[model samples]
Target: MKTALSLCLLTMALGGCGNIAAVKSFNTPYGSPTSGDTARLRVIADGMVRAVPGKDCVDWYSPGAGVIAVPQKGFADRNGESLGMPKGATAMQGDVVSEVLVPAGKPFTLHFLDGGRGSYNSVTNCLGMFYFVPQKGADYEVVVHGYSACGVKLQQLGAEAPVQVTKAEYCSAMANF
Candidate 1:
């Protein structure tokens, strides 16, 4: 379900899918994704955004921490998908959230990012860029967002250790992890 959706045909823009496929965490700050750096493997940010190691969780969604980042470029005609905050298939519970932190038993490693968006012209797909954490109580390991189809996806990257995401889903923009 890793789609760049800028129209497809990328093995990282036509070079490789080589097949190392390893991830423990990443949103950066030393918490995963490295055999010393394997070129980002096309970046879809696995399992709550992975690239883990040990304690490298620096600052996930920082600005004001009320957390919401959806700087759109193409939202696939407003329905394909984008990480804004409005697009409804299942509508995803409520509040549009994702806040996570992992280390106890390791749920695919952990870090966080995700806001919310989708306009549902029947659901297409296009996603990238947008990070938010607006700055409240701080501890925001996630802030989540949702909208996806076919391959199914949802966001909110785990605000701080709350697992169980199947095709990806989010709703909880942050009031306190």
Candidate 2:
């Protein structure tokens, strides 16, 4: 499992992970701007693969696709849409956060950016994907802990009464990832 995740991450680091140009089909053009009210989203996506006690790894596949978001109308597409996170664990991984503007008021599925491998030898350790709805004008912070599990966690980082997060505060919070 570790080897697979490592390979995926390596591919991503080498620019082999699914890229916008690598996808042959699409619901919209690659890198198209949000079509409606958009909210800023900050994500700390992780691609680490951890071993769970007594559980066989089912997601040992290759081609880490970085982070991906698909609207309800679009099928899975391989592209480097996530913030810059590496394929495996490294001291520099903390720097690989992503911020993007996505359509608000719609539910989108989030996929692991590191799951862009061409095929799979197993199934359990498959990358985790989740759903989210971004409120118009609201900003969100999400943390993706690993690839082999559904560790996608999120919180609203903005204050309702117009409070801005300080660099110190954000840096402190990011350390948890």
Candidate 3:
């Protein structure tokens, strides 16, 4: 009986370890646009950010798209320089930015993940989703806010000032693909 109980406890602990997911790079259109019909998107985050890359969200565990690690502002490498952005991309005020190109006039979704705070016993991760339709030849920026909760803000860059884009509610049950 003692040996059976020990084996059962070990199995339960291993099951909990299977919940971790590997990070996958975004595999769609990236880098600068080749033509004049694509838009530039810069994602700013202090933690891990994963994107669905479509109008709808599928299975929560499905690896739909890419992942980016945006370290906190002023984070530097052993060489003491800030993290790099893509070629022809600019960093703002020491912010670590991940730049990508998405087809214009299409909807895109981003999932901001906050790894949470505190030690192993007290940590609680949070997730926030935001989607927006990009206009051709436009520039946009997404800022992720995280702490006890997670949220995101999208802005259309240009004009006299940046115009805020409204956050649309997303439901995975409506996934078309």
Q: Which one is best on lDDT?
A: 3
* Best-fitting candidate, scored by TM-score: 3
Steric clash count of candidate 3: 1
TM-score for each of the candidates: 0.22, 0.43, 0.56
Candidate 3: misplaced stretches above 4 Å? 1-19, 23-36, 58-64, 70-95, 118-125, 160-177
| Candidate 1 per-residue C-alpha lDDT over 64-156 given as tens digits, one digit per residue, 9 for 90 to 100 | 122121223211111112323322234233322222222232222122333223343334323322222222222222323333432213333
lDDT of each residue in 36-67, candidate 2, tens digit only: 68666665554421111111121212112122
Q: List lDDT for all candidates, in order.
A: 0.26, 0.41, 0.51
Of candidates 2 and 1, the better by lDDT? 2
TM-score result, candidate 1: 0.22
| lDDT, residue 149, candidate 3 | 36
Better of 1 and 3 by TM-score: 3
